[model samples]
Target chain A: MTIDPAAPPPRPPGRPRSREADEAILAAALDLLIERGGGATSIEQIARRAGVTRATVYRRFPNLTGLLVRAIEWEYRNTTPEALSWPDVPAMVRDWARHLSEPRSRRLVRRLYGTVDDLPELLRAYDAAYGSHRGRAVRNTLEHASAAGELPLHCDPETLQLVLSGAALQHLAAYPDTTAAQDVEAYFLAVLRQVGFPSPPPAHSTPPRRSTSR
Target chain B: MTIDPAAPPPRPPGRPRSREADEAILAAALDLLIERGGGATSIEQIARRAGVTRATVYRRFPNLTGLLVRAIEWEYRNTTPEALSWPDVPAMVRDWARHLSEPRSRRLVRRLYGTVDDLPELLRAYDAAYGSHRGRAVRNTLEHASAAGELPLHCDPETLQLVLSGAALQHLAAYPDTTAAQDVEAYFLAVLRQVGFPSPPPAHSTPPRRSTSR
Candidate 1:
């Protein structure tokens, strides 16, 4: 809970209970929603996790379903439509690797897809969030790369993005279970190497572009 | 219904009402299942489509729900676990291209994906059907390509399959309104070209083998 330091003074001696309780409740709800699928997650459980009284939770959300809708909305409040000012190409590359490696991010993906069978509406919302939010930034960064002559001369921006994201999406779908971070790292590196990233190229050895062994 | 020539021939009485009715019902049920989707499609609609009495439809399938399950099964009766007996790699390649281009195949894919939201159980069954029935053959064919020394030295069979199928799957999911055959043919060809298919390489030189333009 962030208080507006410039505009607001302390209302009273006690902490800001409303904002703190709201954040805690949403965060805890998010955790349970992802970790426990739909059926096991309940308002009581969210209240226990948030360490707020049931009355406090009820005040914000009348029921469990309503809380779930809000929890997802809260989680997505700051998600950039795409990569936002990712420093540079290398940082952007590293960003993808880090997401796969980190426990929380992986769990988030697992939790999202894990609900597809049981809660298709939730999955639909997830798709809407996932599609526009992060895609634009990555696309912008890739376009910048092409403009800067950092990509192959013939590279189509959409095609390159499709290859990179599409390849990763396949693995993510095939293995909904938590993946090994190291394996994912290795996989990312290999994908980059194969695609022939122009800057800070990994190795000298890549196959002939137009091979014909048939 | 085929009459065995060696055995007693069919009595020249009349058409087999039961078998004919069953086939007509199943065909109509499939059409409605895919066209109208799960909601509006009902036993009454199916009976009308089949030009059969409501009683005849009921005798064939006791209820609408039971009919839906059987309709999917009937549609998949001829599906091979993989490309059944292709002449060569090009033929195997053509197999995928044809599937994407042909109306029936594309419609089948569209209908299957279109059901994910409203009919999750059907989708789950579809995953089971699609997974086991087709994945093995593609995997086998790709392995054969690698064994033939036609793949890039650094190629991973699994990754290649993932990229090809995953990329195509993404497009197929996005556009279900029967994509133009030429567009799909081009898409399939581009996918194969990028994947570095060695057999009968296409015109035009490719990018630098180990491009480091930066």
Candidate 2:
């Protein structure tokens, strides 16, 4: 552990390297939330888990609510695929199956729903930051499917969106354990079929192309 | 309001008339839970609201968990219709619409979901006492519909049950405010149509008879 005189001194609090600390703090908050639910989580616990001082955490996030909201937003950004990347409904379904199959995802979702009464701001922040964007993307996909004649003639896009979202919630509640990604995807496909989605996902006349941005 | 010595000594604490006090306490517990959410509710408040002593409540139920569980069960018994009473799925949908339109019902359901982590026992008790029974009934209804050609040929009864239950949850999360019963019913019917339920409801050959038990 020789100190190199030519090297810059260890970075102090609020230094240019603070971005690294910021990410660490947010990641730690999300981890603690998933492992120990909302009621048991605390700033002290998060700081300890992140290997930072309490002052470091407080300097970055003045309050627990702000920190939690930021942490959840980070998780959404890191885990969810970009809304515009999916080529079709089946692609979206496949991505959702992968997300839902993970036990960590299910636990985090449960905490979100379970905290609505206590910390409604968290859900509101999520809705504003990610939910609305994802919802619009889904609606667009459904509309395209309807136009392509892949959906039932009378199917309403709004109702279908609600049904699909509800089905996800229902799955979390009904099955708390981890499941195989393929099985979950298969189940959602069956639900789609029941809801008038054509089997084989309607070979697009234009053959939808994957987004090149990703 | 004169006390008569001939009035059977005012009915001691352990008398058979305790059922009256039992109902009062349970009703009060539910009222407090709905009005103030789960985290803020307590036995003392329930006792005061019910016009009974705290000891009376404790005598009937030893713990908060037991009291809340029984209170929720009592609510289900009083509000939900018998499983066998519905002549068809449409009838059940109508009843659900009415239930969903009530602000009190929605708030109570929110509490149930919000307390899942803090009070896992409460949700588990509910699942055992009422959820399983209601789930079976819904499954039976869907199965009947499938046999009668009301549902799509590819529709799976289990999947449909999950989707319908999920839709109810999604409705609650999306719209926290009370809606017109007719609007809710219409929305649900549209969902059913999307899931392959024939519109205008099926005309029964036997003219499905409503149960006369009531």
Candidate 3:
């Protein structure tokens, strides 16, 4: 008997689309990306590892770039830290640095840079997502510090944003493989101190209270 | 008569490997690089602009990458400041920023970044050239500043090198089109001030005293 091309494939009665299939595909894509880098990963390999037919993969993503973008978005959504309620300026900046310096995040960033030259649209989307999410948190922290009189009075939020984000991004670019989380933290603290943030008081010492005898 | 397959061509009677031809080709290459970025220029164009035969260009430099590297070296040699003496640390840093912020240098750097992914050998050559010239100058400046009490005592020269070079490189990358030389100067000044360099004395209306009044 001839199969009908227009007909939908038969499924088990009352079965919903499997979320597990989506996860498996994305996980397979990430593995391929990390193993082979952006240039070498192919749709065929991804489909094979996902244990899905090529039709299923293509139905989800029209092209490799689409699949890659979706895979990145999934990874980012899963990896991003939960909303932080920072207690102080120093703590907030440190947390921001920590989030950026994580190994998975660094790998994602490198992959983004690798593809940026060929896929300008993808780069724009990545930047928009990054700016909307991480950028907002950084700006909020800077504004809070300014209001608390912790940051220099002359500091412009935009300039500070450029300095912090640009420096962090440049550090990643310059040292693609070897930079560590603590290195990022130290650099952040140095930048803060350079920009006139007062160092936090030493935890080990309590100053003597002035005598009220006079 | 058929030319011998393995024999080298004899030099023309009147032209003894003209030095002028080499200089003209190099000058044309530099001009093209500055005006048209890297990807658009070719050896044929360089030869035509220099009023030399394509064979002459090939004879001087076997490949395009070699030609570009030599052009960079020539540019650096010709443009680098001859006066080694720096009156102050801040002035030195500001001058370095100003040089890198120039349009020609910025274009050269962008071109270098473009080729880095495809031509790892060329990248290594560029790095070596840069390190030998600019890196040495930077190290010397930091050492001089430290000895003169201009730089802070605690700053490691190597760490300072990475930070300063990374910052300067990123500044070029960020503002590739603008003639914002003053922005770079201001940035270097801000970095200097942050690192504890003494700010220039404020302007005074009255004439200075010859002797101390204390």
Candidate 4:
């Protein structure tokens, strides 16, 4: 697995795990996860695909479940809670919207959700590692926006979280095939409007409007 | 499966299916569905649980898959698309909000979503049955509300659908504990505001307000 550069170094041990072996195993597991999914992907298959010995793969990850978890984290490294841990509402929303608008992102989300029912451990692990990441991302970003005077002082972070996650879930439902940036923006604008946001026409053009009168 | 009251009756030769037998089997299947979920529940378990022979259950449902579908319909008959086919945004919103506010309803939704990944057919059956029910319900209701001049004439049904589903999905996330009517209504009102609806205090009170002098 690709460790974050900022993360502390691996713990001291008698023999260190091979960095190259770790990458190959994770890469193989990641592909199987998407192609075959949770219940179907096997450690044996991962070993074969990675061209690594089963003993070597098991030595690093300990079990198939642990390996799968590491693979998920590795594949979706860009979507990690830490990656979205910043506090810029528009930037975060735009970033999130753009990412989720992709078909591949939708598939990844679907795969994750597909397993949430059958794999309780995965959900629990995600809740801890990601801090229930989707909700946290929107809540933190909106809170920052409200504090920054970009949103109403009384903007309800909880409600904004609701709008965000809700749109995301339904996006998987109604617009699963939609990968265009404009489509994501339409949904994003609709959400901002729902929360009483005085949305800028573009990210950089949020001018205040004067009420038109005859 | 039990046909809707308006739906035409099933045809021809064989002796009529016993109402009591159908109810018992459905009740058993529903309980098992919630208790064990889609994967673990089976025709054998359902037959044993209902105190009916395997042949009897199979005769009515054809297979475990069909039985599960009927059970879903049976458990959620009240929330079925036919039940919400009418166009009354306020009433529809109230009903939808109330249904979603129930803990049982949330559990049901979670269970259904939990299986959507592995069981594409379940999702397909629901989409066909409900006509993407969440979006359709919101759109139909908003159409009525708009025509009645209760909301802005320019209100977008598709956008409203997005907001409603977004809120519902978020409800599944952050507000799993919220069963209050007021909580659902709070989210509902935010959606109305997004659409520029001059929301009345209640269904009975929609008086136009005079602008206050500063």
- Tell me the tens digit of each residue's lDDT in model 3 across B67-164: 87787776656434354435656666767767766776666665555444444444465566564566677778887777876665546566566656
C-alpha displacement of A3 in model 1, angstroms? 30
Whichever of 1 and 4 has more lDDT, that candidate is: 4
Those runs of model 3 whose alpha carbons end farther than 4 Å from true positions after fitting are: A1-25, A28-57, A79-85, A152-157, A174-180, A206-214, B1-95, B98-123, B142-162, B172-179, B186-214
Which segments of model 4 are wrong by more than 4 Å?
A1-67, A76-90, A115-118, A127-137, A147-149, A152-155, A194-214, B1-25, B39-64, B76-91, B130-137, B152-155, B177-182, B186-214
Locate the minimum summed-lDDT window of 10 residues in model 2 chain A. Answer: A78-87
- Return the top candidate by lDDT: 2
Summarize candidate 1's per-residue lDDT along A1-214 as a digit string, tens digits.
Answer: 8778698775875458778889999899889876765545778899999998889899889688667767777777777634455755566666765666666655555455444434545545655666455566667778888888876554556776777676665555454436665566566656654445533555777876885777
**Of the pair 1 and 3, which is ahead by TM-score?**
3
Error of 4 at B197 (Å): 5.6
Rank the candidate models, highest TM-score first: 2, 4, 3, 1
Interface RMSD of each: 6.3, 2.3, 5.2, 3.6
Q: Give candidate 1's total backbone clashes.
A: 7
Error of 3 at A163 (Å): 3.1
- Return the TM-score for each candidate structure: 0.57, 0.78, 0.62, 0.69
The predicted structure with the larger lDDT, 2 or 4, is 2
Judged by TM-score relative to the true structure, which candidate is superior, 2 or 4?
A: 2
* Model 3 residue pairs with clashes: none
Winner by DockQ: 2
